[model samples]
Target: MKLYIAEKPSLGRAIAAALPQPQKNQKTHIELANGDVVSWCIGHILAQADPEDYDAELKKWRMENLPIVPEQWQLKPITRTRAQLTVLRKLVKQADEIIHAGDPDREGQLLVDEVIDYFKLSKTKKNNIKRLLISDLNLPAVKRALSSLKANSDFMPLSISALARSRADWLYGINLTRAYTLQGQKTGYHSVLSVGRVQTPLLGLVVRREQEIAAFVSKPYYQVQAHIALTSAEKVAFTAKWQPSENCLPYCDEEGRVLVKALAENVVQRIANQPALVSHIDSTEKQQAAPLPFNLSQLQISAAKQFSMNAKLVLDVCQALYEKHKLITYPRSDCRYLPKEQLKQAKGIINTLANSSLPCNKPAQGADTSLVSKAWNDKQITAHHAIIPTEKSPENSSLNTFEKNIYLLIVRQYLLQFYPAYIYQQTKVHLLIAGGQFLSQAKMEKQLGWQVLFPKSKKAKTVNNSNQKQHESEQEKTLPPLTKGQTLHCQQGELIAKQTSPPQSFTDASLLAAMTGISRYVSDPAIKKVLKETDGLGTDATRAGIIDLLFKRDFLQRQGKAITATEVGVALINALPEMATLPDMTAQWEATLTAISEKKANYLSFMQPLTAIVTEMVQGASQQSFSGLPQVAFKPKRRKKTFTKKVARKTG
Candidate 1:
């Protein structure tokens, strides 16, 4: 009998439904018409054993047992999942063939592979294990995956990569945590001092940003503004900003803001009540494509901004939509581009939305399907495409408020692909007044196009905040048709003083972007280039959890949406060595891990460097001093005194 083991029940049901006439059995397993059995795992049935599991003596924190590297890693069944493991063990023992149908990511591969390894190592080795890789959990996707089952051995490299990551994290977290805690104890401080591969580096980002903000000193700047009355056929007035002159370069910075108050006042006096000439008038038409679909990080950023939701909450919502409602494709995708082949299914998916309960009306429905942006390139697609709606129409689906909002966001992006580019005409006028040059600008919308879909949200997913500022600045009061050498009267001029502000604290939106593209924060050019080749800090699936873990450990605190490192967090960072806090370590590890996943490198090749790094860290930590850390009142339990004091009491 053939047995299919899925990562979760929702996926198992989807796969079973794709088969012909699958029936529900007594133990909740699905019996296929072809006499196959389908079972599911909640996630991981078995996990890496904790330190105490290896040796009871290791339970007590000690400096001598600093680097707790496990010679032979062991696995134990999770308490709540043991019953499910027993069922799977029985099914695995009887099956002639086993099919592994986990999620199509590194963690997913490990989840199923570990369960099989548990029984295989203890019992008999089987050569009949097959693997199914599916990006979506819908029926058609399931059927497509089932038709091309690969030998389980083919994905052993991914499993190895996942195992290496787990073991490496275990070694680093276990050893460093104990080393720090024991050191802290000597200084009369007692806190867990929890640390991890990704969480520590992430906390370092927050601490550094906070330090930068705290050390920043604001400086005053000035700009001269002019209100000019156009000498046109009709009465017209507009505002213009004074431009930098040759002598003003020392007192002025980019964006034409002058640092000297006297210079700005002089410019205003010179330009005030003077006749102005239109030295140049330029207008250029531009086109902007709609936003690309959401990868997990982008979606998390948007959700955080629009709904004030955290990254983990956004991931949960997207997961529900994908696994339970079957409304969207996979949620843990890193690619923001879709496969070219998926363009064929775009019409059907859109047609369903057009006819479904979504608020899309005639104009959105009339979007032209022939002109999707270059985001349809197949080569850009990673393990999965961007999150988009499945063919399953959510007409009567029971969706909560959060789900509906996120679903609408996805649908809006998908509909935008079919719409024409947003078109506008940008106008800039350069005016010469007295002794200074002034400039005015305006943007006239030629067509709303795809902008109509996300009427209030961002037009492009990857457009940075700097680009957004430029787009906002391009839009101003409509400029009257003017030609070169046209004369205008300066109605008024004033010196507006402003202060240069420090960088703002990170919200979830900015933090997620930074984590996704962390190379921006690194100072080393070689490491920056290396980090860019490998996507930033942590995988999309793991970054949210890393951030969440920091909060749980009191390493970070949130006020409204702004995140800041706690006192303990900053001190903890100072307590550790540079190797523990720098992004280069994780970045290099990720690059090597990628090589391992692609079969370019083996586990030993990848681990040798990490082993050295860990050893160096342990050696350095032994000599490091920690003091005045946030104190924890740790009172060791008093042992019972079993001396014979009874005889003394009787004599008294």
Candidate 2:
């Protein structure tokens, strides 16, 4: 009997349904009329054994076994899902051939592969094992995948990388958490102080941003504006603001916030009521391409920014859309570009949208199918394509408010690819007034294009108003036809005083963006370069969880829409070593992990350096003396009990 093992029951059922007229066998396993078996793992059935599993003495938190590296790594069944593991093992024992039908990512690869290793199936029954890779759980996608089963050994690199990541996290997080918690205990603090590879670094970002905001002192500045009126043949006048030239320095700061009120008053007095000549008027047509489709991180950030939904919730909704509703493709994709082969599927998807009663706003119902965009390059496609709607139409589908909003977001982005680029005419006018250079700029929308699908809300408009006010001289207005040397009246001049604000506190959107583009945060040029080559802080599949972990750990607190680091969080960063909290160590590991994925490095090669670093961190942490241990005098809040034994999930 052929057995198909999937990551989860939903995926298992989807696979079973897609198989050719498969018959349900006791609902435990689906059997093809020709004798086949289908079963699933409830995520991970077997996880890397915890330190407690290594020995009884290790169970009690002790600093003596500071750096516990398992000489022989152990795998044990997750207690909650041991029954599922039992059922899977039984099927594995009976099946003539086994198919590894897990998720398409590294973790997914490890989920089933680890099960095989747990049962000692690979060493004994290697010849009959095969791998299946599928992005979407849709019937057609599953069918397409069934036709292309690869050898199980082919994904060994992915398995190796996943195992390496888990083990490394175990070495660093297990050892360091014990070391730090014991040290804190010495200082009368009793808390399970966690440490992790990506979680600590993420917390550091929030803490540093909060520090900047707290330490910031606003400085006052001033800018001179000359409001000018221009005339056309129709006797109608268009208003324009005079922009200051480069010489307006000493009067302004680096951000162009005018710093000297006296200098601004002098300029306003000198230029007020002066005849302003249109020295140069230039108009250029510009086109802005539609945004690329939603990768998981991009979608998370967008959902957070637009709707104030947290990253974890957005991911949950997207996953529901992919797994439950079946209205969208894969949700955890890292790639924002579609494969060229998927271009054929785009038209059908567009037609489906056009026919369906979309969940988008009323104005977005009419999607333009004629706008073929530039996001269909195969070369840019990664492991999976961007998150998009499946061929299945969501018309008349049952969706709650959140699901509706997320679905609409994905649909709108997908449909936008077919819309024309946002076209506009940019008008730049350089003016001469009383021996001072002033500039005026304006944009006239030629075509709304894809932008029509996503109209900015009032809040967004208010936020953009600052940008508009920043370029005070370039007001958005219709420019009347004017030639060189044409004189215009400067109706009024005013010196406006403004204060320079500190960097804004991170929202889920901004923080996720920082995590994704972490190279910008790294001060080390060499490390930054490597981080750029590898995915930052955490993988796309893991970033949302990392952010969620911070909230759970009380490292970050949400104030309205902004995220601020807690005092405990800041104290933690101060207490920890830079090697543990900084992005450099994790970045180097990510680089080596990528090398492992690309076959440039083996598990031993990657783990050797990582193991050494973990040893060094544990030693440093053990010997180092911390001041006061950042005692937050409050009882730990009661929440859902979180499992900490898993190496894959940790928050430092």
Provide the clashing-pair count of each candidate structure.
Answer: 0, 3
For candidate 1, the lDDT comes to 0.79
- Root-mean-square deviation of every model: 7.3, 3.6
**How far is 287's C-alpha from truth in model 1 (Å)?**
2.2
How many Å off is the CA of 83 in candidate 2? 2.3
What local lDDT score does residue 188 receive in model 2, on the 0 to 100 scale? 65
lDDT of each: 0.79, 0.77
Q: Against the correct fold, how does model 1 do in TM-score?
A: 0.89
Give a tens-digit lDDT track for model 2, residues 462-571. Answer: 22344755333333356777788898877667778778889999998999988888899899999888888777778888888888888887888989888998877877
lDDT of 1 by residue, 1-652 (tens): 8999999888888888888784765454788877889998988778667676788887666777767777888888978789999999998888888899888778788889989888873333455688887777778767878998988878888889888887777677767766776676777766567666778888888888899999999889998889888643434377888888888888877765689899888877777678999999889998877778888898888888889889999999999999888999988887789888788787878788878766864544786888868679888764568888888878878999899988887777777788888888888899999968899988888887877765544543323366776556655366777889889888778889899998899899999989888999889999998888786888888888788878877889998889999988998888888778877788778778878988988898867777777777877776766774777787442210100111111100
TM-score of every candidate:
0.89, 0.90
- Name the Cα RMSD for model 2: 3.6
Residue pairs with backbone atoms closer than 3 Å in model 1 (clashes): none
